[model samples]
Every structure is written in C-alpha cells, then in structure tokens.
Target: MMTPLGYSIMQALAGPVFPLDMANFFLWVTALYLGGIQAIALMVHSKWLKRTAETFLTLGTVFTFIFFYFYLNLRILSSHLYEAGELGYMGLIHALSMKNLVPAFIEFASPLQHIFFMFGALMFGLFQISDKIKQISLKTRLDSVYAVVAPPCPGEELRKAVGKGERRDVAILYADLWNFTPIAEKEGPTATMGLLNRYYALWDIVVRRNHGNIDQFVGDSVIAVFGLIGEKDACETAVACALDFLKEFPSLQADLADRRLPLVKHIGIGVHAGKVAIGELSAASGQPRVAVIGETVNTAARLDSLCREFKQELLISQTAYKPLSLEMQSHFQPMGEVLVRGKNQLQAVYGRK
Candidate 1:
C-alpha cells in the first residue's frame, strides 16, 4: 500500500520522471498504503485498532483475488465492444465492468473495513475507561476503611499526655483472639478477616468510649492503654474494658453466622501499668503514636499468654490492680499465685467476677 505514496514522494523529491508500468505502479501503491496504515496502528495504542488491523490484513488477500476476476471480465468485454462498435451495448458492458460493479465492491468492502476498525477502537476505549474507574474506586474505598479501622498517629497527643508529669504512668492492656492462627488455618483467610473485623468493630466502640486509647492491633490481638486522657481510675477502666469486651464478644460471634461464618472467638486480655515513651514512630507523614516500655508491658504479655493454661479470658496484674480505687478492687475476684514463663518468682493474678 505504501508503494503509491512512497513512489509519489520519491518522484517529488527527485523531480519528475517517467512513470512505471501498470503492474509496478499498482504494486508500489498497494505496498505504500499498507505500510502507512501499519505505522498509524503502531502510533496509537488501541486494542481495537490492533485487532482490526490483524483481521483486515488477513482478509485483504481475498480482495486482490476479487479485483483480478473483475479486471479480466472488463478486458474481455472491452475487446467485444471494440470489435462490434455498438455504443449502447458498450455502455451496458461498461456499467457491468466498472461503473456499477467496481464502485459497488468498493462501497461494500470500505464500510465493512470501517466497521471493523470502529468496533475495535470502541471496545479498546471502553475497556481502558472501565479499568481506570475500578482502580480509582477501589483506592477510595480502601482509604476510607483505613481511616475508620486504624488509629490516628498521636505525635502531638503523646506530647500532651507526657506533659502531664515528669513520668507519665499509664495502664497498658493487651488482648489476643484465642486460637486465631489455628482458626484461620481451619476456616481460610477470608472468613478469618471477616471474623477479626467483626470482633474489632465491637471493641473499637467499647475502648474509645471508656477513655482509652487503642494503642495498636497486632494481628488478632488488641493493645489498649488508659491514663493517657487523665489519672482517672486507670485500673478500674482497664478492668471494665476487659469485662465489656468479654461480654460483647458473644453477640459479635452470632453476627458472623449471618455471613456464613463460624463463631469460635476467645480473647485473652492482660493489663499492666508503667512509664512509657509516647510519640509517633513513623517519619514520613507526621502521625502521633506512643511506645510502652519496662516490666509493666512485659508482665502484661506474660499474663495474657498464660490465659490458655489458666483457662481464663481476663487477667489483671498487681500493678494494674494497685492503682484501682477501693470500689474497683471490690469487683475483682482473686486467683491464687501462678508462675509465669521466663520468671523465677511466682506472679499474683486476679479475675473479674
């Protein structure tokens, strides 16, 4: 196809020259035009055009055969008319050879080709637009979900909490969903997340409303701290939160049934109190955070992990209980001394009635 255009361009560039024979002229023209179309296809990144080009090129070979048959008929009829000089008969033959037949073939084939190209272009454009919309919508939903589920960075909040005293003593609580890893293996990843989310939804409301900061969520466990807001009954608040979490878990489990999920949820909560460095850990975007250190944090983990052995859901240490007002201590029932792992001395433990 490019032959026609290339030869014309070459002729123009080199000045006028004698034209080639019919065969050479048509061959070059066909080659130049085909090449130009392919170049255009490459320039545009449209799936429709690419597919159409493949189809058109494949079917283009048939058009050549069609043209050959028509050309032969025209030659034969032209010879007959030239031998007889019957102008009217020649006119009729001319219409069959070139006027009606050739134009009709061109008209029919041109529309089909255009339709193929157009359909391809439209399909490609639609697919691209659809993909972009899906991606944008997914990103937007994820951002919104994160805003609700994840706690805000508390860089400023920690400073304010720290400024309350030379050493800010806060009660840290850790709660782990019992058998979460084993449950995930049994139920699959989708059901496990759904179960975890339902459980978080219940605790999020309880902890936030009780003047507690949801410190962090490690997999299926929740770490919350109290006394950040004020020096209120820190132990009492921590105990209440633990008891409330225990109470609320059952209803949350029932809700999972509606989603075709099993309801096997148990959490072990360990509460301890000590001084901690509080601030944002991430440098990228200024997000506020708090870091709890010392034996208070360690004891909390120790007590929480021991829940399985003791067959209890909530455990409060002596430090966490020491700050409790008389009324708060009255609500807690004493469980005898128990030895914790990595500790030589036995640690006292308490349970809520």
Candidate 2:
C-alpha cells in the first residue's frame, strides 16, 4: 500500500501528457528543489566543498540533466502508451510538446525532490547538535580539572583593590624539588612530567593539611603563603607544612626507585615572615596569574636558593624562625645570620637537622 504522500506523487506524475500537462510544470519545481539540496550540501560539507565547489557545481548540473532526461522519457511513455507503431510519434511529440509533458513531469517530481533535500538538512542538523554537545562537554571537563588542579587567580579589579596598599604580615614558604632538572633531563619528558605530578600531589596534601593555600608554582618550585586575606597562625602553618612535606618525601622517593625512576628524596624549603604586595599580574598571553612581589618574596626566594650552598634541605629566616612555636623550634637547627646577595642588610637564615 502506498502512503498518502507517495500516492500524491504518483497522481501528480500521471496527469495529462499534452494539454494542462503537470509533468512539465514539475520539472521546473524539481530543478528548484535540486538547487536547495546543492546549497545545503555545500553548507554541511563546507570544509570539503570549499576546495571543490566548482567541480561539485559542474557535477550537480550533470545530475540535474540526468534527472531531466528520465523525466522526459516518462513523458514519452505516458503519451504514446507503448504501441510499436507509435515510437516515431513519441519522439516527435516530445520535442514539439515541451510546453506539456516536460513542465508536468517537473511539477510532479517536485515533492520527491524536496523530500530528498530534507534528508540532507536533517543530517546537517544532527551534526550541528552533536558538535555543540561535544564542545560543552569538553569545556565542562576542563573547568572541573582546573578547579581541582589549579589555584584561582583574582581578577583585575580585585587585584587592583588589593594593590591599594594595606599593611599586613604573611608567612611565606618556598619549596624546591631536589635535583629536578638533572632528573628531568635523564628520565625524558614523559617520565619527568609523571614525577612532577606525583611531587606536586604530595605538596598539595601537605599544604592543605597545614591550612595553607599554594600561592604559585614556578617550574619545580612551589610558593605557599599563610596569613593574608583568609588565614591565622600563618607562621606556624607554613613551618608545619614544610616539615610534613619533608617527612613524606622519603617514602615517595622509595616508591619512585621501585618504578625504576630517579628518586627526589630531598627538597629545599625556605620560610620567612614579612610584608608582601600580593596581587595578580597579567601575563603576555593575556591570562592573569597570582603573584607575590616585593622584598618579602625576594628574600624568601634567596633563602630557598641558598639551601644548596648550606648543604641542607630546609631553611627558615630569623623573622619566621623566632616566632615559631616551641614544638616547631625543637625540630630546627640554628644557622646564624648570613648576608644574602643584593641586600644591604644581613638577613637571618636557618637549617633543618
């Protein structure tokens, strides 16, 4: 049984072949439908068609001509009714009655032609929906990962507000993975990245446990600050986190050796208490990054770098060292004041035994 739509196509096709010929009318309608399909095909496959539009346009014209030819033949058959003696009359009338069957057949096939175009439109619509969903999913995943792995940096207006100058003390910790560059060069990029991830994870745990937020990561170094916008006991917190990081390092080192990778068994930490201009800086790439600048951060970094010279894994400046709790002071060894380079005044530095 034919559907109503299919039957309508048949009735439209089987109309008068001469006077009032709907077939010829249908040809022009079919051509218009084909035009729409071609336009849609160009849009759906724009990337591929951009290089080949002229060729596809030429090919599309050929297909239109082929369809027209089939329509012409249907007309001849409908007019002559398949009689052996009528072949000549069929060709003769087809050429002469162009105003009849040609137009009627085109009009009849118009709906079928448009129906074919709808398939192309449907496919293009599905592709658009799929691409939209994929983009949203990718963005969502990226946002979630960022929330877990990266610290948030304040926006421009917020940084500007912070930069207006407020006097406040901050406990700062500078942590450097032991011998990172040489291990990275020896292990290759993949293994090196894996090692860094494990190392950072340990830092994350220690810092978070001690109620400190990671301020920033610079290569293999992490800067964590306590006491500032939202913290108390900043000095004690920074020292506790550094000590905890050291205790976890040896076990982590053993695990790496088991995996046939170089162990980062030791790391250097430098802690200092001082005033800092903590705010955000816009990078060259137009992304904002949290930064601590001023003498406090400089002094801390200088002390961290000095660990290699002192043959020790951790150090605390006098400002932070003196304020430590009795329990915290018990674990540290006093290394007398040293004149750090690029500084006019002598700054106190200590080592962990």
Candidate 3:
C-alpha cells in the first residue's frame, strides 16, 4: 500500500526526475507502514495491546529516523553528482551503493539519539510516579473503610471471613439506654444526638477494654459479642464487660448533667453465651459489616429487656453465668426461671445481688 503512495509522492515532488532508487523507496514504504501500525496501536486499550503499542512506537521512530538520515545522505550525494556535471539516475545509484551507510548514519544520529533517550527516561519516570500515587490513594481509602467498620482483623483476613462466614460459640451482650425515648423527645434532635454520641462512646470504651467486638448499634441499643474472633472465655469477658458498663454509667450521667443535657438514668445490659452464626450484613449505606444472629443473640436481648422488669442494671442468663470465676459469680444471685417473651421454655436470669 505504502509503495504506490511513496512512488506518487516522489513523482509529484520531483516531477519527471524522481530521485529515489528501489532500495530508498522501499525504506520509505517500511517507515510509513510502521508509523501507521504505531498510530493504530495507540488507540487500543487492552494490556497486551498497550505493550505492543509501545514496542511499535519505538520501532516506528527508529525506522523514520533511519529513512530520514538515509534520504538526506542520498540527497546530498545526488546534489554532489549534479554539481560535478555527472547528473544521471545511474550516478545517484552508484554513489549510494558505494557509500558507507552505517558510519554516516551513526555520525548524524548520535546526538539526536541521546536527546531521545533522555526524553524517554523522563516520561517513564513520570509514569511510574503517577502509578505509585494511584496505588497509595486506593490503599488510603481501603484503610479508612477498615478503620470505620473495624472488623475483627483488617485486610485479607477479614475479607475471607466475611466471604465464608462462621459458626462459633460467642457471648452476646445487648445493652440499651433506659428511658431514651422520653429523653430524646424532651431534649430535641441536636441535644438528643449529642447525648447519644456520648452514650455510645461510653459503651465503645467499656466493650473494647474487655475484648468485645461491637456488632451494631440500633437506635438506643448496642449489640456486642465476645469470642467472635475465637476468644477462649467469651462468657466471662461478656459478663465483665456488662459490669464495666454499669460501673461507667454514673460517670456518663454525671457528664451529661454537667453539660445541662437530659440524662438517661440507667442502662440495661444482658449477657448470654451459645453458638451463633456470624456473617456479613449490609447496612443501609451499602457497606458490609460483621454481625451475629441466632437464638443466643435473641436471648441476650430478651434478658436486657428483663432489666426493666427486674429493676436491675444488668442481667445474665444461666449459660453466661456458668462461665464466671468464683469471685465473679459471687456478684450475682439467681432471679429464678421466668417465661421470657418469644421463648417456649422458662429462662433463668440472674442479676447483681
């Protein structure tokens, strides 16, 4: 295709005296073909195609430079032949055939080659820098998500766990602010939100200190679990965590009182231990989080509800109470079996005696 195009271009430029020999004309055709391939390859998006494009670009550039230098040398040789009164196509061919092409090309192309090498190096450096910046930005965003969601372990481990899910014996702790609805209504939105923030912060501290993973916060309630990451004494740790919340309640109340905000008088916490299914759940915001669900979790929430009925700050079911140390067990007395809502059998609940 390029052969005929080159022939026509040469005829148009030189009229009846076309100067390029067959070899020179073929070089021009090869350079134009490579340049065309380079242009086409640049428009593709595939990985392999991009790599091919780069290879073609370098080859095309080299070919173009070779053609340019050779053409220039041929022109100079032909002009010399014309000046010496031996102006003929045969003279031009004979001059080109005898000339030492490699040395001439090297002499003319060395300086320009160094300049091109430096430019290529600069472009490659910039590309590497840009790629690094993009990777860092992506990592930052992922770290932010991990920090906020706070899975048992960040990165690949958490992703694998969330993917497959697990069934484990865990101690579930359910805590709800006593009388929060009236407080929210009386305080209004801004004050209510501020109070909730402080309240949740207090729970967060107490829960984390006892090695508990907060599963979710639903309205005025918080659900946390121990042994989600395979802790040995999940039940004991949960009971201790609930006790800490009771101990911290007054400080939180005092803080609210100092701030002139409507204070929640008490918080009800319930602890229960059993095998539950741990899995990922999507929030309304479309972010996935780890959570637990089963009869054990429900029993814990029911025990928390029993706090209002029993007029106690903490309630622990029999399963949770059984794992406490002797000294820890001494803190609570059995409340007897009672008909808990949504359960067929009576559940034995205990509270601090």
Give all candidates' CA lDDT scores. 0.65, 0.67, 0.73
**Leading candidate by lDDT:** 3
**Backbone collision tally, model 2:** 16
Candidate 1 per-residue C-alpha lDDT over 309-344 given as tens digits, one digit per residue, 9 for 90 to 100: 777888888768887888878877778687754568
Off by over 4 Å in 2: 1-148, 151-167, 230-232, 281-289, 341-343
Candidates ranked, most accurate by TM-score first = 3, 1, 2
Cα displacement (Å) at residue 282, model 2: 5.7
TM-score of each candidate structure, all chains considered together = 0.53, 0.52, 0.54
**How well is each residue in 1-353 modelled by candidate 2, as lDDT tens digits?**
12334534764676554322334444555556556656755475343343244334444555455555555556566556545555565554553354555565566457776556545555555565455444444433322332234554554555655564565688889888778899889889878866766667667777778876677877788888777564667888898888888876775665556456667766778888888776656679877765666677777787788888888888899889888888888888877778864567887777876
- Give candidates' CA RMSD values in order: 17.3, 18.7, 20.0
Superposition error at 219 for model 2 (Å):
1.5
Ranking by lDDT: 3, 2, 1
Q: What's the distance in Å from true for residue 219, model 3?
A: 1.2
Model 1 regions lying over 4 Å from their true place: 1-148, 155-159, 163-167, 339-345
Model 3 worst lDDT window (10 residues): 142-151
Candidate 3: segments with Cα more than 4 A from true spot: 1-163, 282-286, 340-344
- Per-residue lDDT tens digits of candidate 3, residues 77-136? 678877888887666555554254555445545677755754565566556545544444
User: What is the clash count of model 1?
Assistant: 18
Most TM-score-accurate candidate: 3
